[model samples]
Target: MTAWDQVLELLGSPLMQRALLAAVLVGAAAPVVGTFLVQRRMALLGDGIGHVALTGVALGWLVGSWAGLVPQDTLALPGAVVAAVVGSIVIELVRERGRTSGDLALALMFYGGIAGGVLLIKLAGGTNANLISYLFGSISTVSTADLWWTAALAVLVLGVGVGLRTALFAVSHDEEFARASGLPVRLLSMLVATIAALTVTIAMRVVGLLLVSALMIVPVAIAQLFARSFNRTMTLASVIGVVVSVAGLVLTYWQDIPPGATIVVLAIGVYAVAATLQPVLRRPPPPQDPHPDMVDDVLLVDDVDDADGATVRRPSPTT
Candidate 1:
């Protein structure tokens, strides 16, 4: 059979289709959420959460072995999800409580989770190879179970994102003012924590916890190269993410490289090209007229609000 025929054969399989679908959704969703994290200067937050996700994977394995609730090496979705959420909350709370800087908190939580996970693995007597696969994902290992769980979490992330849009915007612009306005800042902060945790938990199975942050950051980072407005940035980020992931998966089949790493490397390449072209595309602002200032006599002031709640601005920015 020809190469095209082999590719078609793989695509025709239900399992392959499921894996592709999962990759597309995660590729889109991670960057969509990541834009917010990146804008808030919380980029390191994803890295921390991704590391903590390893603890969840380990705990899930331990739970499976101890309870005999699920077969060994089966999807441990629930255990991982729970552990990730708990760990994410712990990290955020540490920051909120003034116990440490966000970076320090993340490092502590991540290394602690890693240490704990290693101990658990040792206790379970699982082989090093098993841990290696969990640390770095194997595409062939992404089962139907993983796809379903990832799909469900993707939906949840989108839902929470939509519902929290206003609060997020407010908090992003001015946290102190948002709190003063009684916007439930603390609750919203926790919700953001939950969303970050959820993103990491679901992505771990596909990319492995070791590289989950790539899924979360790469697309958004690339999107930043092309978009100016926040909304446009997110939309473009999702599209870029989905396309890169699908392309990477296909390349993996051909080149025999790991799918997750391939996708990330492709994203970085795109970002680099965009970065190189950005300066050339951006035009310098037209020079201002050097004549007398036309608006020197204008004294701008905020007009009082009328009954209809419209502010009649006499002059602003024109002066």
Candidate 2:
């Protein structure tokens, strides 16, 4: 096939359609919440929650494979959501009780959960079929059910995200001040955690748990270098994500590289280029401070007048 035909053929494939849809939807939801996640210095929270999704995927596999309650392919999501919620609550509890930082607590939780998942996999005789998918995502393995789940999750996440935009803004900027201003900062934090967890779960199906967090964070990180407002950040991040997703899929199809890894590499490339170009594309400065101390002598001189009413002020000299 010619190169153009090959590209067109891949786009027409059912698996490609499903994979692109999942990537686009998850990409949209991820960076929207990620804007806040990055600002709050909780980028690792995405990693932690992505790890938490592994527990869900394992449990889902176990239940479907062993208990026959749900199909094997369907196991990953429920387990991910439950584990994510638990991880969020645990992070909060650890902060309140142990006085530990959220990062420390999340690190502990992620390692502990991974250890537990390994033990569980060993106990189940370590089937390579289900385990490999968690390590490296398979776009071909994504089912219609998984696509529907992702779409539903995307809608729910975006709804909460849009409705509580202000509360999230407040919490991201200043938790104490948000609470003082009568915003439900604690509740909003939970809401944000829940959304993050949900997005992590859905995105895992597209990118796998190991690299899914990168999809959530890297795109937004790149967009922030150029985006002037919160809205612009989300838009640019989504656009970058979509472009990378499509390009990654094409590269994966041609080179037989893992799609998830290709996606992350493309995202990193975008960030690297943006970072390099940021110096040349400086944003307009924020509004200047109103205080007189901040005003330059030249500017202050412009504000003053000489006895003759000229704008320029004469400097005093001493003999």
State which candidate has the highest TM-score: 1
lDDT tens digits, residues 57-144, model 2? 6766676667655456455678778988778767756654544576788888789767666666655545656666776677767789
lDDT for 187 in candidate 1 is 78
Off by over 4 Å in 2: 1-4, 69-73, 96-100, 283-319
Residue 70 of model 1, lDDT score? 50
- RMSD values for the candidates in order, in angstroms, are 8.4, 5.0
lDDT score of residue 262 within candidate 2: 87
Question: Taking the tens digit of each residue's C-alpha lDDT, what string does model 1 give over 117-166?
Answer: 77876666566566766667666677777777888889989777766767
Q: What's each prediction's TM-score?
A: 0.85, 0.85
Error of 1 at 218 (Å): 2.0
- Worst ten-residue run, lDDT, model 1? 296-305
